[model samples]
Target: MGEIWMIGATGRAGRNISAELQADRHRIVLVGRNGQRLAEAAAAIAALGGPPPRTLVTDDPLAQIATGRPDVVVNTVGPFGATTVPTAHACVAAGSHYVDLANEFQPVQSLLGLDPAARTAGSTLVTGAGFGTLATEALVSELCAGRPSPIRVRVAAMPVVDGLGPAVLASVVDAAATGGLVYRDGRLTRSRLGAHLQHTPLPDGTMRATVAVPTGELEAALNASGAGDVIATSSEVPTGRIARVALPIVGAVLRVEAVRRTVIRLIDRWQLTPPATPGEVSWAYASTEWEGGETRQAWLQAGEGYAFTSRVAAMVATRLADGDARPGAFTPGALFGADLARSAGATITLDSNAKDLR
Candidate 1:
């Protein structure tokens, strides 16, 4: 069995991925900042009738990865903007595979930019191994397969997460601070934070409101469809008229270093109510248009967002550890194909005909 080191093992996503890895017979090493929490998480893993996980309490996860090179390292920490690049670099230097559930645009693009380095180091790096990026990315891939590059592409993520964690909140804040982005004429361009508002039609005959956000799904869709223009929207963010008016101002304010830090601190200390699950299904929609007016649209349907993310992260880490993936950097669907989504308990529906492809 390959040795898998899970950073932030005390966190929700970390614990779930650790359990999945252990259940698959991989040796797990739980790494976190809190010794007690790490020990507790290890005990929980041991209770699952698998080999008890080893624990490492460290403030510098990069140093640990460099010193004790595990076969694979799964990072559940965020804002991934701060953590992803450095940690992935450490794993590459140590000749270890790296996987993270990062869905932020900057981090995901930064990590994928490491493709050459990872290949040279014989390491595999997977980012956005989660719902937002993977679900939409898989749909884009399916729509574009065996077809020419699309002229335009639009993707929407509507995840029904069960709860909110501090890390997630921090990531959201960081993404907001990064401002809005879209691919225009094959170039990354800045836009208003809540621009390109769309009412995406779901498979269940429901319409969900989404607004453009600078998410990794934007990068994923661009890469998958080779579209000259791409916009990634999400239902998670407020898209009302007032929200649209204020988003640009809020984003500008958060861009200040001190202000962002202060906001993150407040989020950490505040007692956030457990986010109620919005619905039973999470949907990701993608529409691709060709130059000749031919168009294709598809939807990826899955269960709770967190559960799918945990499974996708676990599956990616395990496959990397088992040497089942090639040496390079990629998002999950980019590396493993759309079938990865299906294996992680998602189904794809194509166009008005609503043909379900497993």
Candidate 2:
């Protein structure tokens, strides 16, 4: 069994991924800031008839990781803009594989930029191992397969999450502060936040409103389709008319370093009410246009977002631990192909005819 260490072991995604790894009989070490919470998470795992997990309470997880050097590290901590690069660097230095559920634009691009270092260290680092990036990225990959480079690509993520967390809120603030970004002529371009508002159609024959947001899915789509122009949209953000008018102003205000930090600090202390359970299905949509106006569209249908994220993170970490991945840095689907989504309990549908891309 591979030795796997889970950072933020007490959080929702961490706990779920821990259970998944336990079911596969891998050895897990729970790492967190609170000793009691870590112990409780370990106890919950043992209560499921699995072996007791080792728990490590440390304020400095990077030092612990560098010292212990587990075979694989799964980082569930968010504001991944701050956590992903440092943790992945530590893992590379320690010669361990790394995986994280980061869907922010900067962090995802920065992590993927570590490909040379990871290859030199013989370590695999996978980022965006979650619904937002993988769900749409996988579809783009499928639609672009066996085709020449597309001229334009658009991807939309519409996940149904059951709850919110402080870290999630903080990440949103960080993303908003970064403003909106799109790929134009193979270059990253800045745009107004909440631009390109779209009334996207779902597989269920209903329409959901989405707005362009700078997200990792944008970078992932560009890489997957080799498109000269790419834009990523999401339904997670407020997309109403009022929000559209206000988003650019809000983004501009948040761009102030002090204001952004202050907002994030307050968000960290928020005790938000748990949201109602998500609907039965979530969908990620992507449409690609080739040089001569040949266009292809696809969608990936899955269950609740959090459960799918847990599964994807767990599967990616497990595969990395098993030496099934190449020594480099990549987004999940970029490393494992579209099949990674299928393995994580998502189904892909291609074209207007609803042909299955399984």
Candidate 3:
């Protein structure tokens, strides 16, 4: 097996992915800024039934990826808006495949924009290799298959997370600062943050009040379905009646650049904990309405968020390492199809019986 280097190897998601990749018998090189934490993570991986992964402590990740020349580099670092481009470029330069667990809008779009370069360099770059984007994207792909371009596509991500770290909080704040966006008439347009609230029904016989968020799925859905209108939402936002009333007001404040930065810093410094533990199952839902009045919906159910994310990241990296992926920048679904999501433990269900194509 070729050596795979994982950045942010000590992070929660990074450690889990490391163990999974190790279980597949892949040689892992743990890369992180802290030596002690990396050692501990390596030990944990070793305990999981693999030889201790080689560890590299480095502040300059790009330089290390270039010099070490691993077959694949998995980036688990957050605030990927800042990390994705540089790291992906380094991978291209080193002729190494790159994958990141990024679901943020800017990073996902930014990474995809590098497709020409990645193809030229003969390296595959994949973003949103996590539950946040993959599940929804896969559903969109499934629904739109063999159908005319959809006029509208709506997607929602409802994940059950056991915990949230300060970094996750910071990422949310950063997304809020990006405000809301959706694809309309085949072009991206801005919308108010937390706008367009809806009670999204899950396949598990329940509904969650979701609000529009500028998630990477918005772009992925548009690409997958060729939809002229797209709205990406999430159940992560506050959904109560009172909370819904106040969200727009809060979003207004967050839209201010300085205020957003201050909020992120405060959240980071205080290390705020999320209020509740999410449920055991996570879901991704999407509905598409086509030009001929045909409508279709699909659902993806998976285990808890972080564990699912680990599975997805490992699966994508494994595929790339084994030469299953072609040279291009892609999301997991766009590259490997919805089956990859299923292989990583997501149950997919499509609803087309009620829709008439004729």
Candidate 4:
């Protein structure tokens, strides 16, 4: 059991992470912008078992975190693109391991650049511990587990659930609007978003989403700590048609500096979407294919994406606490076996269209 200073403890992923960590006998220090809300999270964590770590509410919680010097710091306070650098530095300075659930690629890359500094400080700094990179990366890596050459890897992730926060949505738009980054013909290249749409079979029938570019983290993992030429794509489809209609508009707001910053400020002002409602449930379906002469593929279903990510992150943190993890910037796919992703409870299946090997 380790002590965790959870920075966004009252948020959706934070609450879920707190639950997962508590189940493992780790202590949780719930920190949020609200004292009442943090206290509530603390109470719920306490009920889960071994006395909860202290709950502290402060805008600059790192000062408080430095004082406690907990074993781990889970920064569920995203957007990672905005907060990872500072939080990672603080964790290193405090001699605590750092984990986050950010969906953006830029910030994750930033964290990777800090590897040497973190090691010098004797702390492990991990990014993409959550859905944006880890789960999807893990799913894709597992699809081609033991294969070698002449392999073609393709991924299509479609998100269907409550809307992503503007920052997250922007990350998708930024990658999409920028163009597609595909590992085609054994090399990485760029194309446009919405240009790679495919009709995939879903329980409700054929569902559609564009095969967008791969995240830097995903590219690194699929390439095996940056080795193979694996093509990857990620996309978002509205859970409801209304959200679909609003996506372009939201994407627009993100493109403009004033609107983008305003939206971020709004997130900070509200402290959360839906004004203190932490009930965030997200879902996604990922279909992947790996082919040498024959093809093997799988459809991965995560009923509630963020909820599952929180669990994955907690599990990673657990491994780190016990010195069971490698120190550096990483994704679960880069570390775990196929069973690692499966044991966490995602629905996995062999692609039906897979042709006969013989």
- How far in Å is the alpha carbon of 223 misplaced in model 3? 0.5
- Pairs clashing in candidate 3? none
Worst 10 residues of 4 by lDDT: 274-283
lDDT of each: 0.91, 0.90, 0.86, 0.62
**Better candidate number, 2 or 3, judged by TM-score:** 2
Best by lDDT: 1
Give candidate 1 misplaced runs (Cα > 4 Å).
271-274, 352-358
lDDT of 3: 0.86
Residue-level lDDT for 34 in candidate 2: 95
Clashing residue pairs, backbone N/CA/C < 3 A, model 2: none
Backbone clashes in model 4, listed as residue pairs: 180-191, 223-227
Better of 3 and 4 by TM-score: 3
Candidate 1, residue 141: the lDDT equals 96
TM-score of 4: 0.78
Tens digit per residue, CA lDDT, model 1, 98-133: 999999899999999999999999999999999989
lDDT for residue 80 in candidate 3, whole number 0-100:
80
Question: Over the stretch 142-171, how does candidate 4's per-residue lDDT look in tens digits?
Answer: 555565542454555554444344445434
